[model samples]
Target: MQLCEKYVMQLLGMSFLQYSKTPMNDRWRDKDVTVFTMHDLVHDLARAILADPVNNKGSVVGNGCLYAFLTDCSKPLQLSATSSANIKALHFLDSGKLELRGDAFSLGTCLRVLDLSECLIRKLPESVGQLKLLRFIRAPRIRDQMIPNCITELSELNYLNLRGSHNLSALPESIGGMKGLMHLDLSGCHGIRELPK
Candidate 1:
């Protein structure tokens, strides 16, 4: 079965877009690339539901502390330190390459999941390693960046996607020591000569 199908993530019957370039094909086979997306209305409703009044983070009940947010911020990106303490997720999939090398990691102490698709974050702060609860990270296309060795300290992290991050010459030496890491995607990373031993 397909990955989405296996995960039961087929949203609205059209929740995913596959990469298909073959011509003259009527039938759709299980392809390699699968990108998840939803209709604009679905996105709108999600934003509305996740909108927090005071913290400007995301929550199902608006006032509750399910704090997560979708951002499309520009340069000099930052978040409120006090408010980010309880935040759980932060998605920058829509935002362009953000240079989040500042207060974001230090403040977002409770971040469980973080998506930084194509972000310009060449390196992360040491504070990110301190977030013990971090479980997933989707940081594709951080080309030539040096992911901090501190990242391996996240013992709770289970999933990490770094596809298309070309020119990343090395991974943390202790990457294999991350016992909790169940998945690691390094597709299109052409710079690495070999996996860590």
Candidate 2:
């Protein structure tokens, strides 16, 4: 396990919350980190590594490691400018509303995990399919009626979640073609009347 010692401790803690499933091997990162309280850590986020809240409008915070949040996506937010290429995960905070530019999905080149379960965006950007290395996706409750067909191209993706997605009505026609898909969650998706044939 090449995961840093701190992240290793994090996995142990997440297991206590019934969040981290057992990984296949060292190469597989246990892909679940939910909000949980820990000693010295109030919840999932440990601390802010970088911040300039006073001048920053709405920042994407990452330190070539893990986790970033787009606090304000009232308009089309640009992630490419703030985030580094080495980030593994990105999550949107604030619980208001979000709108991301399609081109902004190019988060450097090495994003592996994404958590959009909180952001109530109008739609899932088509560019999301371009993140070919992504292994985990936790996007739920999107406002769009359909997910982009191109998302089926993510060959490394294993987990896709659309829990409580009230407006997401249809999945990609080629969903079954995702070679690495291991787990899919459709719980609470009220708009989907039938699964793709």
Candidate 1 Cα errors over 4 Å, as ranges: 1-64, 72-82
Cα lDDT tens digits for candidate 1, 1-197: 78857554433222223332445333534565444445343353356445646443533343254444445433322443235666666655445655655455556666766666635666555667777878767777764556879889999887787877786888999999999887798998888778898
Candidate 2 local lDDT, 154-177, one digit each (tens)? 887877877788988788888988
The global C-alpha lDDT for each of the candidates, from Candidate 1 onward, is: 0.62, 0.62
What's the count of clashing pairs in each model shown?
0, 0
| Deviation in Å, model 2, residue 40 alpha carbon | 24
Question: For model 1, which pairs clash?
Answer: none
Show model 2 residue runs off by greater than 4 Å.
Answer: 1-66, 74-83
